[model samples]
Target: MTKFPVLHEEQVREFYYNVEFVEDDSLHTWVGNKSLYLDEELLEKILELPDMHCAGVQKKIMKGEYQLLFEFVNKVLLPRTEKHIMASSTDLFVMESLCKFEPLNLLALVLEHMYKTVIEHKGKHRMG
Candidate 1:
């Protein structure tokens, strides 16, 4: 799993795309010299998970809405103990991902974020 997400900064206005860069004002998340973009395809994979897998907190998953699903994805797939507080969530792209059934490739996105965290904070005490 990717260690740190490509978050959008509601605080920083200087950067284009409102993208949060990690450490030293440098873009820590990158692929081929360009910054890494966030992916919502994780949502697609989550949608397909068996109802049994999703029955953890809720008795059953409600398909029409994805907020619960997104939180579940974060908890299980992306893996965070924090439940319900989306962190850096977006809805439109997730809806777009949910609307489509085509196969999604999450490998590269996963790699970049993982690599970014490793390269940026390889030592010392803090982690993202």
Candidate 2:
């Protein structure tokens, strides 16, 4: 079984607060005006991959593999969404923009949020 990473909440909060969003008119419009949410099924699929544990995932993101990461994100996470479809051809472009501008900051934010979300869901199920 794959385990989600246990990120330090304080560090994650600091990163979340400090990360800057660069102005990109194209990507901004492509992503739409809503907050990006990861798909549960995509998260599960990633967790199931033998080589896709938390540390490895983080390493890949930090190593500038945003294209691959977003490939999975677009295919499994955001597929079928209007925003995703609209930006399908421009996935690489947007990812490059994010990598060049935000670096690993955005990835860290997403991973931190995803980990907390999974934990909260598991807790709810156990309690229910």
Top candidate (lDDT): 1
lDDT of 2 by residue, 11-44 (tens): 5444333333333211111122333333334444
**Residue-by-residue lDDT tens digits, candidate 1, 1-128:** 76997765532222232345544323433433465443334333555422111013331343545656565555665553334443332222333345575333343334344544445444431332
Tell me how far the alpha carbon of residue 54 in candidate 1 is from the true structure, in angstroms, after superposition.
25
Q: Which stretches of candidate 2 lie above 4 Å from their native place?
A: 1-67, 72-78, 81-87, 102-128
Worst lDDT run of 10 residues, candidate 1, spans 50-59
The CA lDDT of each predicted structure is: 0.40, 0.39
The TM-score that candidate 1 achieves is: 0.32
> Which has the greatest TM-score?
1
Per-residue error at 77 for model 1, in Å?
1.5
| Clashes found in each candidate (C-alpha, N, C closer than 3 A) | 0, 0
